[model samples]
Target chain A: MKITVSEKNGKEINVWFPTWLILNRFGARITWQVLKKHEVHITSRQLRRLVRAMKKCKKTHPGWRLVEVSEHDGGRVVIDI
Target chain B: METIGKRISRLRREAGYTQDTLADVLGITPQAISKWECDITCPDISLLPALAKALGVTTDELLSGKSESEPAVKIVPKDERRDIGDMMLKIVVDSNDGDKVRVNIPMALVQVALEMGMELPQVSNKDCLRGIDLGEIVNLVKAGAVGNLVEVESSDGDVVRIFVE
Candidate 1:
């Protein structure tokens, strides 16, 4: 997934998150939650990795601003898509 | 239009046959016959010939008016059934409060998630998820952005929350 961080000064910064979903924290657990709500299924390991990522990462940061987010065409993560 | 129910009951009475006797001849339960007469559904097309013969009528008579000489054909048309698996869909919604809208997920997407090694609850029914980040679900619900923060409880005790800004 790609996240665009825009500061109050009208400057935008982009960040690329992991895509394995099963291996990446934001990718796997968040995706699984979305899927499961829709009755979609995912592997246990993928879900575990995502949950781990979410727990380990902090939601707020000093340098980056969150302006927009998008998923890549495939599994890879890209910014400014 | 004459329904299957009215036709069956009229035919049975005209033939001087009890529902039980006709049901036995048709190899169906009496209740099944009753359902047919109540307009629940009609008998299968395969039974058309047998039913006509049993009622001392021709297939044409059963399908159309009493005589084939009528100008406008008044035959009954069968209801069309749809194959849900073949359905195609795209959905989008804009919400200011980020209220979680429950949407039905497709089986194909579920299979993809399983292949990716995501863990799921034991129950095999559709559910709703809550989160501000919906990279995967974007393809499913393409609303611009959700701003309402809410918590959704899983069938299990776990709670999924979405914080919309």
Candidate 2:
């Protein structure tokens, strides 16, 4: 997953995350856990704000899609696109 | 606004500890405790966790004067689409008074798994679902109709809801 951060005029800021990561459950959960482990606390309220921002940007920016594979029982991997 | 000193004083008193006793527990001088209670000096930031633990409250409660017992509704942003691949998904909505309603995905998402060549469990709750077409549900979801599937409220003011958005 790629996150882009840019600062404008030392005040305005912009943040973006991979749309596929936001749309996928396994990807989003893994990202949340990794951020928490690194002491970067992103609460649900903050996540909602991020999602709303992403939705607004999706209308303008070209979106990217990804296929995620999750491990299941019996040594199986389920692929979701 | 209550000063940190007043909050410390109130919590210390509520915990039934004299200034000297509290200082003894924290390994600080009684004068320092007196200063903290009088708003003359504040506890170091490093001591907040220990201070909160000593006062039998969370660090948030110690700082914000709001106990966790208060009803603070939190909006959780959830992505429910991944439950589709799991096949054995069950959604439950419940109230504080032990009222609940459950919805089980018997075959809707399971059909997606089937199409993807994943093995389905032999014994499943497939019979529980009413006459619903899995293909139609999948088509609707692909067409972006995957939100707020069902919602119902009981006469006892308990709400049970399921959403796949």
Question: For residues A1-81, could you state the per-residue lDDT of candidate 1 as single tens digits?
Answer: 455545545566666764343345555666677777865565767566435433322222222221222222212111321
For model 2 the local lDDT of residue A42 reads 63
Worst 10 residues of 1 chain B by lDDT: B85-94
lDDT of 1 at B51: 84
Candidate 2 residues lying further than 4 Å off, grouped into runs, are: A1-81, B72-165
Tens digits of per-residue lDDT for model 1 on B49-106?
A: 8888888778888776354554221222233322222221212222233322222223
> Which regions of candidate 1 deviate over 4 angstroms?
A1-81, B69-165
Residue A43, model 1, lDDT: 71
How does each model score on lDDT?
Answer: 0.47, 0.52
Per-residue lDDT tens digits of candidate 2, residues A1-81?
A: 342222323332234445566645555567568756744566655544444443443443333221111122212111211
Best by TM-score: 2
Top candidate by lDDT? 2
Please state the interface RMSD for every predicted structure, separated by commas. 13.1, 17.0
Q: For model 1, state the Cα shift of residue A36 in Å.
A: 67
